[model samples]
Target: MGKGAILGSAALALVSAARSARTVATWRTVRPLPEAPLDKGKVSVVIPVRDEESTIDGCLASLRTQRHSDLEIVVVDDASTDRTVEIVRQHVAEDPRVRLVRTDGPPPGWAGKVHAMYRGVAETSGEWLLFVDSDTESAPDLVGKLVAAAARDDADLITTPGRATVPNSGWWLLLAPTNVLLFDTASPDGSRGKAVGIGHCILVSRAAYDRTGGWRALSGEHADDVAFATAVRDAGGRTRLVDGMDSITSSGLDSFGAVWRSQRKSMVAGGAMVGGPAAGAAALGLGGLLHIAYGVAPVLMSLRGNGFVRLAGLAAWAAQAAAHRTYMVASHQSGATAVLAPVANATFGAQMLDAAWRSVRGGNLWKGRDIR
Candidate 1:
């Protein structure tokens, strides 16, 4: 090989090594909080429900069996047209711990979920606030573990990655990996110096919530969890991510169309918050293209019989996949999926492009609302 080729390879290797070191540092710095056995402080579980009739029953049923006896359940019905309210009311009637609150509309500049969450928090009296989704089913000890984790780590906020129950469809196998990839890239467990948190199952101390100005502070933010965590961290509060896969399962996302629409809406909404539609779209487009190019280069190099180029490409791809798989398995994904990690990474890259283009054209829609 020429000296110029060797120098280029050496530079690439150095960059790769630096990225790996950063990922390792992230994992070591942010360890999972230890599990709490029971709710030591008064705990309130808040669930914001919309048209979740299909899964609300199972979610409430699971909550009813929670081992945290001292906890209260607050369900905010966000003007659903389905039987979601009825199901929640039934659960409320059966157990005094569960209360139902109704909201007619989201206030200006506030997303529906954040508006509902504010109402739920206002109606509950607990030292700890747990914001859970209506489409999620929790294990009996889920609340206890979250509370325990919070206390053990002195975390101001705690979030978990739940199992994504994708429907049995080819689209799901192809696109579902984007969610995992996002978590891997943005989460502290996967990358260093990256702010990370998921909204599905977030636990915040009442003090921390109040100090950060609660949901009202994040009222205008589309990615409320990320905004809230950033606020906490900026205020010198600690946040931790926990493994909630076995403790909670999500309703199966059954349609490819639904996944694409949902993701597009989310990207647009989040993008809008960071920048206007134009800048956000451009950022997503550029990032997506780079990711896809990197992912496909290895295959192209190998096919061309360029051993040096192929080796470099393969190493880069493997490093990226390994980092992603580490985050997935740590979050409780099955090892079987790890074997398909490269495929997942590539799919994620493709989805980013689709989402960005859809967002720019104002094609993003969700829950009967056009986020863009």
Candidate 2:
């Protein structure tokens, strides 16, 4: 065969493989579990809070209204100098299920969140342990669904990707798309079984938590959620991911600055965990540049009128965008955001490039810490 034929065959094979993998990862319908038997296993919910006064109330209120009855809510105040503690106190006063604990400071060699979670876990007792972020609001049935998923699947660790609600601002429109795009692409259905889950919401059986040594086992890791998931999988424990749309919504990002700093910090810290600043910078930089190229190349091809090339590019972009929209719609994201997904994807590619450069320069910052 000619070189062109060989190249064409290779391209076809690559596309076929990607499509097959994506299909395998797409969500499939599962038989819903029967209403969790009333008075089912007890659950202890642990949230780590630090200067999150503005968003803590909604998060706490949502927990107060959980459909599940046997729940104990524990909020660990991670040395917040703001009204975070006061807010928790108010919730604790109003709700008997709520408890507040305070930690002095994060110990050396531990991430702030891991440290806070450890503190909260030490003070709670239940058959199940849930670690949720302070900025996340759970649906009344969120806990029930998670518990049901665990019980039905006999899973040791269960996690759901939280829905991101970006503010209606140009800045957010441009930058906050990173999470939407990344999570949507990286977190297809079966992918969760192969990868570590995000920390935004994680639920584990108390028995599994104890067997794995819980938060303490991953205290030194920056990407605690992913590390914990890996640990669980490594130990022959079952891990499952559920569609969390009916279960939770993240407090929309407050500003573009928050988005930028958060992404940069994540890249740096994640990089450090793997191979330090240099390796992290290279990975982010190359990955971002390639993604940007992928987004831009189709537009250029369409303009050039190379019919076959244009068709291929358009099809690829549409496939990716539609897949994202389907996931968002399933997650109950606003129809408007789903429609604007292509724009969101392009913006995210740009922001990732910016984060890559910062990570390389050793200038990533998070929670007042220089991770790089």
Candidate 3:
């Protein structure tokens, strides 16, 4: 048994345990907002659509069946060259509560989604506004529950994380924990206490939104959710991040390319939090440690060591695997995906390097627009 292998195994095990504890401590599960009726305030759901024809109907259907009665759905079409407009129009015709608006295009310096949300907000009037992605399908009580939770906590903004649905591929599972970690760090409990709003389903009071400068304030940022949360927190507004797995699910990934593109975009945008390229490089080094220590080191030790070293390596690997499994289950992913932890860690390491490269190069393309 080599001294180095034993030391490495101990360190890796400790890291895995610490990460698992942090995830558990930071995880915020969503409960039903309240048991009250919908007489509190008028709620407006602002959905930004862009070539989401396939998923638009289901999303609209979810909104239509909301338990909350005083709700208006505003769908902002970002010049979709598809049936997105047609689908939204159909909903508008059938249900008076749904309205469709179009955006000419995002002006220079404005990200597409942020621009669409800004336009949607302009066309709708509601005491409470919910910005939901077009691909997300909400449960009937989602809006009511979120509104009630915000009111109970006296929170100005509430962001809910959705369950990821990747029916075709398991590789996409790797990206799930990235969000869990991000959500943990982005919430008030992280080092910065900066509450980052998850874009899939974010609910905010109109007054609190205006206090943080609203969509206009996040116009130039590539990652509007995090930027918006930072703004809200800066303005002394209470920001809450909750679990939306029961209330909403996002099935946007149909291919590995989709997974890659989404992960790349997030990594690039997330670099803004730590100081751009330099921070990304530093993070890459740190991310590499997980794969090397937990995945590669085990294999090397088992092959090279005599007895105790091999056992230590195996134990560390098991610890990491268990920690990863717990995280997957907590994040509403299939627990079976934990068996693929090594692959996930390797992919993450590669993605971190790729993200650093993209950050150094300025920005990447998202939804056919450059995010810089």
Candidate 4:
């Protein structure tokens, strides 16, 4: 390799090593799920659905068996064209704790799921409220455990991370870079300027939620979870992201197209919400560049370069893979996915660029709604 090539590879190697170190450290601080059995509070689990027939039943099946005896499950339907409502009706007849709530749909200026969530909250009277996506499933003790963690930590709102299970190994490999990247950087508490939230499993106290203005405040928001968490923090309430990987899972976004749309929507909407067009665009660009450089560059150099260039590339790739193992294990993903980082990074970088383009050019839709 030329001197220039060797110098560039060595520089990249150092950058990846540094980034990997920081990523590993941040993820290491994420508190694990509480193991000790604890007291259960009166909790209401609200599931807001539009057209989720394929996954709602599995979600309910997971909730109904909750060890938290003092619990009520409310499945709010927002005019699902499919059998989502009918499926919930069957569960309602069987489980006394489960109730079905119907809503006409969101009024002007309100997002669909946000409107349903608002309506669902009105029908319940629990000290704690859990807003779960219809595609997500929780372990029996999930509610009890989160409630306990919240109480012990004085947190008013808690978000448990659950990346929907990717069905195709190849698709998952494509997604691995972004997943590990996010898992490494997301704040475990709402200490950042705006908290990034996991929509599928949000646990919040009714008191704090009401004080923060609840879903009503986020009626028009496409990024409702992040908006809600930000509201909680703005109101002086504590919002935390806890480790619920072992207890929560979701069967969502099964196809590559679904994955692409989901990522784009969040990137476009989340960036706009946080920093408007310019800052968000800049952030996405920088992040995409980093992911590509860290994940893809080294692998290429390792594969094609000679001598020191190849060695530096190999070292960087090894460092990133080792750092990524911590997150993979925490999220229950196969650690072997780390080897696919190059493909994953390229996929993530492309998605981010897509988001940036859509942001400036306008028009990204979700369920007939223009999110960006």
The residue-by-residue lDDT of candidate 3 on 1-372, one tens digit each, is: 568767866776566566655555565343434655344788999998888989999999988999887999999988898889988889999999999999977888777888999999998889999999877898888888888878777788888767766543434345544644564456542236567677888888899889988788878677778778778878877887766677788877546667677777777766655675677656755765554445666566556756777776666556556656766666566667665565566666676666667666764357665554
What is the C-alpha local distance difference test score of each model?
0.70, 0.68, 0.73, 0.78
TM-scores for all predictions: 0.87, 0.83, 0.85, 0.85
| RMSD to true structure for each model, in Å | 3.4, 4.0, 3.2, 3.2
Off by over 4 Å in 1: 1-36, 165-194, 252-261, 336-340
Q: Output the TM-score of candidate 4.
A: 0.85
lDDT of 2 by residue, 1-372 (tens): 356634543453345236433533454542233355334788999999888998899999999998787999999988898999998999999999999999886888778888999999998998889999888898788888888788777788878766666643333345334433344444422235344476778888877777778888888777677677767766667777666754677764445666565655666677666587777777777767755655555455446635466565555545545545555455555434544444555666666677667676653266655665
Count of clashes, each model: 1, 1, 0, 0
Candidate 2 deviant stretches above 4 angstroms: 1-24, 29-38, 164-193, 252-261, 334-345, 362-364
lDDT of 1 by residue, 1-372 (tens): 666655554454454445545454454555554554765888899999889899889888998899887889999988899889988888889999999999996978888888999999999899999998877888888888888877777777888856666633323334334544444456543223434676778888888888888889888777777677777776667787776676887764446665565566667777766677788878778767765665555445445525576576556555555555455556454444544445554665676787678677774267776575
**Minimal lDDT window, size 10, model 3:** 28-37
Error of 1 at 65 (Å): 0.9
Model 4 alpha-carbon drift over 4 Å, by segment: 1-11, 163-167, 170-175, 180-185, 253-257, 274-294, 306-311, 356-364
RMSD of 4: 3.2
Model 1's C-alpha root-mean-square deviation from the true structure amounts to 3.4
